[model samples]
Target: MAQMNMIEAIRSALDVKLSQDPDVLIFGEDVGYFGGVFRCTAGLQEKHGLHRVFDTPIAEGGIVGAAVGMAAFGLRPCIEIQFADYIYPGYDQICSEAARMRYRSAGEFTSPLTIRTPVGGGIHGGQTHSQSPEALFTHIAGIKTIIPSNPYDAKGLLIKAIEDNDPVLFLEPKRLYNGPFEGDPNIPAVSWAGHELGEVPEGHYTIDFEKARLHTQGSALTIICYGTMVWVAEAAAKAAGIEADILDLRSLMPLDLDSIIKSVKKTGRCMVLHEATRTSGFGAELIAEIQEHCFYALEAPIVRVTGWDTPYPHALEWEYFPGKARVTKAITKMMEG
Candidate 1:
């Protein structure tokens, strides 16, 4: 076992994949020489030659398009889109081409590529640098969505995503890149240097993306969340003195609905939490599915605590973000009734 931060764990995963599979390639803006904007790919270019790890122009479309072509030609290409907010320019290649490649070719062609990007707020990135768009990708078919909250899961799930047969959107919560955040701005940011979640495996590992991890088992209520919201929900539950079953939904697209239903049915209450906007976020789909399966078992209406339906604000970041106070209030309300 090795104690590594999220960035180091991710870089280690890429290093292992590149070394094990000759066909695996990594490329993105500043990923080669500078080692990525956040240094997730730091020193990888020096370890692995430019052929296996190189830099690309500031073109999201071309980056994803070329990855699709490479994957279809039997090479496993892993591309990075600096931030989740900048992925729109490559929407055509991702949603249209890479997503439909297998079905369009009648299973003759498959785009086995991984698209990694940083998502969510809490770093005062305003609107452009911070956005959680997992719902957009989840709405589309033929692709898997992933968001890991800790370094351990980050490394394991990333390795699995890279080896998967279909395209995977691996969204990393930048705020949690070094340490876990629980939506409390008062507390100083923590690093993974000495945290238990930072104790990651040294080599290759895989965490099933379709499985939901039960962080805490309780019967009062169930809290379902992913990414940065997982930590926030836990903090809220603790603050509210609520014994709730917390489930970390590592994968969003191939959602572990069975696990969600089981928890909801056992607890008799459910609250979906996410960092995305409230209207059409992935939390909506989660609530819908829970309602469909656990309606009879539900003791109260399914609740959701999400960001407001407005662009992420630079000055009013916390106001827009659904923080611990917001989540605690929602859980308290649910338990009251």
Candidate 2:
């Protein structure tokens, strides 16, 4: 085990896959020479050689289109989109080609590719760089969406995504890449070093997609969240003095419905939280599912605390963000009911 941040853990996962599998290829805007914009692949190209780990043009569509062809030719390509905000350019390729290759070809061809991109706010990136477009990807039928809140799941789930036979959209919360953000910009940021979730295996290991990890257990309420919101949910529960069952959904699609139902049923109340836009966000689907399954078991109506329907504000990042106060109030209200 090593005390590593999310960036280091991801780099380790790519390194392990590159060394173990000859078919694995890593490439993107700056993944090769620049070692990724966030430096997640810093030393990988130098160690793996240029062919396996290389850079590409700033064309998102061509990059994803080419990766689909490569995957068709039996090579597993793990490509990065620089930022999640820029993924729209390649959205068609991902949704049409890479996603449908296997099913369209009657199982003769498969797009075993991983698309990694940094997402979310808290770095003053404004609207251009700080968008959480996960719901768009999750809506696609053939894509598997995943978001990790810490170093451990980031490494393990990434390796698992790379090895999967279908297309995977791995969304990295840039805010949590170095440390966990508990929705408070006032408190000094805490590094992942020596943190419980920071200790990651340096070897090849894969975390199953449908399995969710329970962070805090309780009978009061169940908080279902992923990515940086996991930390925010934890903080909110503590502040509200609610012993909540907080579930970190490492894998968004192929969701662990059984686990969600179990937790919601046990608590009899639930809240869905995320950093994405409120309307038609992934939280809506979670709420719908929870209602369908846990309707009889539910006490209070399910609540969702999410980002606003408007674009991420440039000057009002914190206000747009579903912070601890918003979450704490929701929790208290649910508990009081």
Candidate 3:
């Protein structure tokens, strides 16, 4: 109903969740007084008080370890890693402890924690600060991975991640923090299955985690993407005059195979795009699944537009990152088939 930036929408979700649940708490470096590096957690400390929203030492491992401890004790803690690239310091705590705790303890314990991190390249943050590491966590069994493309989904999905009873890796694209993408915020937050939108309260609401939302419909080709790439693909579609059907994959794990298959069957041509490196990225997995189900329907080979194989570069950021030209080129090539 109201227009808000991606950052504001995220704060709204966190604010609503904190107000609704005493079990919910937030902790991360600079998240308290500094209000996070990107200010996504701004003013939360004042609203919830320092006890519930406080800063942790500059240790990703310790932050994750403490979150696991809190979740085990029946608290829902939302922890933020300053950047996705730096998440490696806490990888052990996440994969070994937060992820496997429930299975290892035979349901005697569980960690209902949401790990939020700003990810991807475009801001000249260089290799260390910008990395899309979703594939790494998606490989793990116990974690739910998500990357939202715009403000509405950013708010809805973050709320969903916080409420889920397992470790959720919530990756937000830094590039889209103040996006100018076009989408209907009031289009009714329906599940990917076409079910009624989860009734998020005036105070708060959580969208379903496994559903894919179709941003625009077309018959020529389907562009499957998440995070900022969704916006890129849409713009490319317009520039190329290709009427590409855009699907925002709101959830990475428990991917909406049905939506993808159905869309591919109709379009017959598909392109997978992301800001992650081309080699061994999520695009490959989506290609495999689509080929499995829609092979006969496909008119062309599945195409991908992604970053180069090298680390995200500061000097060559634009070249390294896929843009509308690259995406349009890929779309035109796919259309030729």
Candidate 4:
């Protein structure tokens, strides 16, 4: 085991994949020479040479479009979109071309590619760079959406995504890239060096993309969240003095319904949370599924703690964010009912 930050762990995953598989290719804006904006792909270009690890133009559409073609021709292309907020330019290629390649070709061709991008707020990136656009991609069919909360899951899930036979949208919470955040802006940021989740194995490993990790088990209520919100949920549960079952949904697409239902049944209440906007957020789908499977077991109406239906504000980041205070209030209200 090696203590590493989210950036180091991700770099390790890419390095391992590039070395193990000759078909794997890494490319994106500044990903080769500049080593990505977050430095997740640093040192890779030098290690693997410019051929396998290279840079691309600033056009996201062209980047994804080219990756789709590469994947169709039998190469595994892992491309970065810089930020999840900036992935709109490549939306058509990801949703139309790469996602539909296998099904459209009757299993004759598959785009085994992974699109990695930093997502979420907390760095004062304003509206453009701070949006958590997981819902946008999750709404699209034929694609798997993944978000990792810590260094361990970041490394493991990324490797799995790169190895998957279909295209995967790997969303990295930029806020949690170096340390875990639980919605408390006052808490000093701690590097992964001393964190337990930062102790990632320096090897080739994969966490099942369909599994949801249980952070804390309880019967009072169930908190279902992913990405940066996982830490927020944990802190909320503690602050609210609620014995909550916190489930970190690493993969949003092939959601671990089994685990979710089990927890909802045991807890008899559920609160779906995310950093995305509340309207039509992925939490809505989770609420629907929970109601379908465990409606009778529910003790109170399902609740959701999410961002407001407006553009992420730069000056009012904390107010715009669905933090521990909001989550705690919701949990308390649900328990009171």
lDDT of 2 by residue, 1-337 (tens): 9999999999999999999999999989989988998999999989999999999999999999999999999999999999999999899999999989888999999999999999999888889889999999889898899999999999999999999999999999999998999998888999998899999989989899999999889989999999999999999999999899999988889899999999999999999999999999999999999999999999999999999998999899999999888999999988888
Q: Write the per-residue lDDT of candidate 1 for residues 111-140, one digit (tens) a residue.
A: 999999999999999999889999999999
C-alpha positional error of residue 139 in candidate 1 after TM-score superposition, expressed in Å: 0.5
TM-score of each: 0.99, 0.99, 0.93, 0.99
The candidate, 3 or 4, that scores higher on TM-score is 4
As for lDDT, the candidate ahead, 3 or 4, is 4
Q: In lDDT terms, how accurate is model 1?
A: 0.93
Q: Assess the local accuracy of residue 184 in candidate 2 as a C-alpha lDDT between 0 and 100.
A: 85
Worst 10 residues of 1 by lDDT: 209-218
On a 0 to 100 scale, what is the lDDT of residue 210 in model 2? 90
- Root-mean-square deviation per candidate: 0.8, 0.7, 5.3, 0.8
Q: Across residues 1-337, which tens digit of lDDT does each residue of candidate 3 receive?
A: 5556778788889998999999999999999978998999999999889998999999999999999999999999999999999999999999999999999999999999999999987677898987999988888888899988777788889999999999999999987786533222222322222112221234575679889989888988999999878877877898789787799998999799999999999999989988898888988999999999999999888888888889989887777888877888888877876
Clash pairs detected, candidate 3:
200-205, 201-204
Q: Which ten residues in a row have the lowest lDDT in candidate 3?
A: 190-199
Relative to the unseen true structure, what is the C-alpha lDDT of residue 137 in candidate 3, on a scale of 0 to 100?
Answer: 88
Q: State the TM-score for model 2.
A: 0.99
